[model samples]
Target: MRKSDYRKLGGIVILLVLWWLLAYALNRHFLFPSPFAVGKVMLCQLQNTAFYQAIIMTLSRCVIGFVISYGTALVLALVTGHMKWLRDYLAPLITLLKSVPNISFILLILIWFNREISVMIIVFFVLFPSFYSSFTNGFDAIDQSLREVMILYPQSLWRQIVKVELPLLKPYLAASYESGIGLAFKVGVMAEILGQVPDGIGKKLQWSYLNIEMAEVFAWTIWLIILLVLLEHGLRLLWKKRKE
Candidate 1:
């Protein structure tokens, strides 16, 4: 392994040791579970089919919400990038969406929709503004020279977008997706917990918390961290391949 990898592994080892020490000092299983206890719970959970099902369900919702939000942002950014008046008109709406507390959206959505739909909608609302901003910034960042060259060459609009805009937007798009996916997952889970969705990781987490199953709660959290790390690693691979 590389030196950096070894350093990171060492850091993780130190962190685990510190956590174990803290848990031992506290001597309260309800409040703090040792890494070994959480690992045992995680092993048990891994044997349960429901754990996989809950992960799949939550992931499906998160992906669907992210796709919709991303697609909408891409289309709107393309339009509003050229239309100053439309951009101005939508500014307040974007600002409102960005500024509103996530809990308010969750509460309102819970009232208006079923638990599953509410979770998806909350993910959408929470992520859309940030995605939209990333895309708009990409559009704005296109070089003036490139704009003039495009005008002089007079390519078809679709061709121009494919050949010019998307290439310029690649970095911004990548940045948004990398950051936004994790945020979407977290927001989706939070919504699920608040909405009390019948089946999800959030539901399981809520149940564990209510029952004061600290080990189970820690296990679930460790699972989430593992999932997120895997997701980010996969995305990084995809992005690296795309760049190549």
Candidate 2:
């Protein structure tokens, strides 16, 4: 095997050994199931249709919330960032949203919206301000000197936006997307679990908790972590391609 491959294998082995030791030390399956047991449960769940359906439902909610929040934030940030008065007007609202705890919105959503809509609402509220701030910061980071140079050559707004602003903001946009997407998924799923939305991984997790199926709970958590890793890496790869 190549050295890199060997190093990866060695790291995995070390991790597995540490996991085994921790599980043995804990000696309580309810609190800490062995990795093998969790793996077995994961394998079983992979064969079950319910698992896939739950995953799909959760993904739909997360993706919808993320896209809506991200798009809205991007547009608003662009508009407000260039307008000092608009930025001043928006500052307090953004600060309020960012300061409020996510769970505080849950009760209001549960009362005002259906259980199915609660996840979307909560995720959007939690995600929008962060994305908005990141984007506006990116816009602010653009050097005025460059814009002056472009203006000296009498560049059109479209040309300046395309050749300068977009490229400069690409990294910030990627970072915001990376940060916001996963946070949306996490906060959305938590809302779903708390709201008891049907046909979601959160619902399954809640059921497992009620039934005291610790192994299944661990399995579900493992799947969530796996999904997050895959999503993050996939997004990063796509952004890297665009940058190139």
lDDT of 1: 0.91
Stretch of 10 with least lDDT, candidate 2: 154-163
Off by over 4 Å in 2: 1-12, 154-158
Model 2, 1-244: lDDT tens digits are 8999899889989988898899999899777889988889999999999999999999999888888999899888777865779999999999999999888987778778999878888888999999999989999998989768877887776676678777898988889888887788789878888899999989999999999999999888889878887988899899878868
Q: What would the per-residue lDDT of candidate 1 be over residues 1-244, giving only the tens digit for each residue?
A: 9999999999999999999999999999788989999999999998999999999999899889999999999999999997879999999999999999988998999999988888878889999999999999999999999899988889898898888899889999889988988898888888888888977999999999999999998888888888888988898899899889
Q: Per-candidate TM vs. native? A: 0.97, 0.92
Error of 2 at 169 (Å): 0.6
**Residue pairs of candidate 1 with colliding backbone atoms:** none
Clashing pairs in 2: none
Candidate 2 similarity to native, TM-score: 0.92
Model 1 per-residue lDDT at 152: 89
